[model samples]
Target: MKLLSPKLLLLPMLCWVQQAAAQQTTEALSDVQKIEYASPGVRGMGKPRGIVVEYERLPQFDIDSKSDDPEIGNGSARVRRHNKFSVRALAPIMNKPQTKLILGIDHSFEEFNFENVTPATYSLYNSLEDKNLKSVGLQLAFLHSPNEVNFYLVRAKAELNGDYTRDNINISDYLKTTIDVAYGWKRSPDFAWGIGFQLGYTFGRQRVYPGILYNRTFNDKWGVESIFPANARLRLNVSEKTLLYTGYRIEGASYNLLASNPPLSKFNDIELRRTDFKGLVRLEQEIYDFLWFAVEGGFRQYYRHRVFDDVGSRDYIIKNDLAGAGYIGVEIFAVPPRRFTEGRKNK
Candidate 1:
């Protein structure tokens, strides 16, 4: 008797084993009550139950600055760095069926430094100055997940930032608020996908220089959000703490001078717009019962365009093509169960 081919013989066994293992894992997880405090800021099914905090550092590089303009000098040869830190807490508001209210605060600081070349020719008076920015924000979210089919999340957030500073001059100050809602479709225990929409509005002021005062204003009123400064994010979960996130954001602003009438024309009004396509991959490892460490890297492409009416006749539009930025950061997570736990533990 001839023996059956090895490929045919092994295929059915592999399928059977896989199916059995999946079923077993599912049953085991079902017995385990869904943890309410998994991720501190965001709520989801099978998330960790506790408060968590994290800190991160990200560095960005612009690759296209090399060939764009010869007269415009290249500032930095190395990567530009941006630092970020965040803290979050989650609590079980009502549990019997497992419901959670998540509260979080995140603070981020960013500084963009440019390389100095041709110090004599491109002096501080002529070269573009470096910038430092700081932002602080709060987030509140409600999460509900009843089985795989019924899952929903809602979040509201507010952010405020001080004026961006360059060469000791204040550039802008901004405030923004955002709201989001999402629904999920979970095909299995290991895989889930979601779609969400975010709407936001920003109010800000821009400063004008002394020489440009006749042409520009000291402060310009501006508002932007989803339509002009908006974003959509797509999220995928690889495990309980690890996630893969990618998204697109568009931001724009227009400015007008105060002294001019029909501000749009006399002010040499201008609107600047940028679109960013970004992706991030993160891994979370628990350091202790309440502490975790996360490492993440992000890749981004930036597109910028500016439209302004020239001092003379016609309008001028300029576009900066795609530029690349890459960043890597590590975060430390700390969560204490109760407010008094810190004092009690020391004793």
Candidate 2:
């Protein structure tokens, strides 16, 4: 009986060791897959989204613009609606154990509807309401890992953003370029972190900023994913098929408008600068294998929404501080198949 007692005590310890080994194996597999398939939005935080369609809308808000020059009009207007829709696709062109290359393309359309202009003197309002702003972007990214723990990523994206009008049709005038570079340490399957720098125009003007990436899985039910100054979210795993996130995101862009629009013709190329800050709650649910649906809603605030002729001269035409409003967004996205995420593990 004494000998049997020792054996019984060891049984639980052996089972615990086996469970730990299994969890480590699963986490290591996730890391291996991330090396091959880095996500487009937040690098290796979560599953790579292959195809995505999204829409966002804002409610009514009051906005008034002031200009130094009276010809451009100092006026107040009520914005009835603001809507945006976007589509994105990502594909891995080259995949290897130590290196990966991905290609992505995205397109967006934005519309603004205005009513009740106090002084119907601004001609630009007609152009703004009638013409939808559009953006087409092309991105290429490369990831390399010299060994199992350390990796670096480089990405470049080019965007053509503007209202499609005969006067604003010049491609060169509408092009905007951005670049991102980072160095990461995949310390374990459950955690990763990195630091980098970004050259982009998320503030409605071209600026350089530091970037930080942190991805941590605390347990099966809770985690965090963040890329600072862009987005940060607290993740909740409600179930295998459902996830919830609460976080904030920064969104902004520069768009080219009609050079022929009135008083601005004396200036150089016309550009509209816009930025939004939002604190949101997002819910993602799997409808079936590989297909998912996401819905998010939040309050939107304007950081800066203005018009400028040439940033070099620093002459601003119209400056606006619109009232805050609630906004909602929905998405339909697809993830990789079992063959890409599962079968590779056995091999």
- TM-score of each candidate structure, all chains considered together: 0.48, 0.85
Q: Would you list the clashing residue pairs of candidate 1? A: 37-48, 37-49, 37-50, 38-48, 38-49, 75-115
Whole-model Cα lDDT of every candidate shown, in order: 0.36, 0.67
**Reference-based lDDT, residue 254, model 1:** 26
Report the number of the highest-lDDT candidate: 2
User: Residue pairs in steric clash, candidate 2?
Assistant: none
Q: For residues 24-140, what per-residue lDDT tens digits would candidate 2 score against the true structure?
A: 122224545643222212212345567888888888999888888877878788889888888878766876655667787888878888899767746556657746788888878
User: The CA-based lDDT of model 2 is what?
Assistant: 0.67
Model 1 misplacement above 4 A = 1-81, 85-98, 117-131, 145-148, 162-173, 185-194, 200-282, 298-300, 303-326, 335-347
